[model samples]
Target: MRAERRSGSLMAAPYAAFLLIFAAYPILFALVLVFLKWDLVTTPVFAGADNMRMLATDTRFWRAVANTFVFLSIHLPLQVASALMLALALNRPLAFRSFWRAAFFLPVVISGAVVAILWSNLYATDVGLINGVLVRIGLRPVPWLTDPSTAMPAIAAMVTWKNVGFYVIIYLAGLQYIPRSCKEAIEIEGASTWQRFRFLTLPLLLPQTILVVTLSTINGFQLFIEPYVMTGGGPLRRTYSIVLYLYTNAFAYQKMGYAATIGVALALIIGSVVFIQRRVIGNAEAL
Candidate 1:
């Protein structure tokens, strides 16, 4: 028994070391950095709560927060609706189903910067695919990335398109576990197609829905690459993200302590939003 215990510890040593170095140490150092002032040049000063105090009244920080929420507002519903609809469609028998599945999932594995760059050209004001279509149809071209009103929406749409396939797989897995007997029973109850789906399929997928909500919320807060590459958080900062602001503080301004503060705040915000989502969705599921 003692020999077996020793072997088990040996097997776990690498994982323990990984957590210590990559996860635990970073978190601890970030927490410590939250109360100090350091620019990576001078000695770190203990500023007590000044970092927190400044963050509380920072207009630009608040604007970035609001911009993230705006992105989420457009993203969440589109992500869920598109993924669910595609999942439902793909769950049925179709020609080349496997190929279609692979095609949809291709973008998810692509590099984020590559995806952003591809979409940037596609969203260009003139000499772009979308605008070319509009002009061919004799309609006015809309400035997708250059207009403040449309820049974030365009990014949200791109993100939804890129990530929807992942959620489709999740919903597909959930669909499989749904007991065949329940589906048959619903059909035999004189339930119409819409009635069966509404009364059975939608309700049975609540857990998957909740999972999607939580994950997409976290991704929404961590948005950086898309805005960074496409708009550079431009068109009047409409697409500025919290992560981008944190990067600017740390690298551009050399405000490591303030950057750490922003990082901590972002973590807190992600946690709080995800917690609220789980509670709300879980309660709805309970009902």
Candidate 2:
């Protein structure tokens, strides 16, 4: 047993070292930087809690947080509904099953920047595909990326489309584990399709649903690449996100200390939000 333990430790040492170097070290350094003002070229100076004070009154930062909430409002439900529906369809035996699955998940494996750029063109006003169809039908072309009201929603829709495949895979895995006996019993009871789904399928998949919500919420909070590529957080900053603001402070504005503060604050906020979500989802006794 001792020899086996030694061998296991040896096998795990590389991963432990990797995490210490890549994850643990960076996080610890960022926490230290939160109290020190230092541009990459300057000697670090202790700033104490100045960064935290500035963050408290930072209206722009609060706006970015609000913008993220708006994005989540749209992205979360759309992601869950679309992914669940697609997964249900895919679970059934269908023609070209592998092809359909591949097509859905293709965007998940593709570069996010590439997906953002592609959607940018598609959402373009004048010659873009959707607007062009609307124009042909005598409707005015909508400024999707350039309008404050539409910009975040457009990005939300794009993100949902891009990631729906990943969540669909999650739901699919959950579907596979549902006992065949439960399905057979539901059919024996002559439950209608929707009733069976509501009473049996959805309730049984509660764990997967909770997982989908928590993951998408985290992804929503970490939104950066899509808005950066598509709108540059423009159209009156409607698409500005928390992570975008953090990136701007660190790289664009050269406020490393404040950026670290934002990073720390973001971590806390994510933990709090995810905790509340799990509580709410956990208390769902039915439906």
Candidate 3:
């Protein structure tokens, strides 16, 4: 048994070392860097609480936070609704179901950068596919990525399109666990479709809904690629994101301490929001 234990430890050593190097080191270094100023070209100097103070007072950082909230407002609902609807459709008996599922999931496999770049052209005002369709349908072309009013919403729509397939698979898995006997019994009682779904299906799917909410919330907070590639924080900084702000601080401004501070703040914010969401949803599920 001691020899077996020794072998097991030896086998796990590489993965443990990998985590220490990649994950633990970076995290600890980031925490330490939050209190020090380093411009990469110069020696690190102690900044004490200055980075934290600046982060708290930074208007651009706060604006990016607000922008994320705006994005979540649009993205969360669209993601849930479209994914649920698609899952429901796919749940029913259909021909070519596997093909359909694969088609929906195809976009999820594509790189976010690629998706953003592809959508940029699709959202172009003058010569875009979406605008061409709108014009053909006797509608005025809308500035999707360029206008302050429409930029975030357009990105939200694109994000929804990209990730809906993944959530659909989640909902579909949850749907399977729902007992058919309950569905049949509800139908026998003359429960209409909506009634059955509201009382039975929805209740059983609570766990999945909670997962969707939590994940979508985190994804919403970590939003960088879409805004970075499609909008570049855009027309009036309408689509600015916290991660992008962090990247700007670290790379563009060379303010490592401030960037690390922003990173710490972002981590805290994500944790707090997800905690609140889980508490709310877990309580709801209990009730």
TM-score per model over all chains? 0.98, 0.97, 0.98
Over 107-226, each residue of candidate 2 has an lDDT whose tens digit, in order, gives: 999999999999889999987998998999999999999999999999999999999999999999999999999999998999999999998999988999999999999988999999
**So what's the TM-score on candidate 3?**
0.98
Worst 10 residues of 2 by lDDT: 278-287
Better of 2 and 3 by lDDT: 2
lDDT score at residue 119, model 2, on the 0-100 scale: 88
What digit string (tens of lDDT, one per residue) describes model 3 on residues 54-75? 9888999999999999999999
In terms of lDDT, the poorest run of 10 residues in model 3 is 227-236
Per-structure clash totals for the candidates: 0, 0, 0
Stretches off by above 4 angstroms in model 1 are none
lDDT of 1 by residue, 21-96 (tens): 9999999999999999999999999999999999999999999999999999999999999999999999999999
List per-prediction Cα lDDT, in the order shown.
Answer: 0.93, 0.95, 0.94
| Native-to-model Cα distance after best TM-score fit, residue 25 in candidate 2, in Å | 0.5
Q: Which should have the higher TM-score, number 1 or number 2?
A: 1
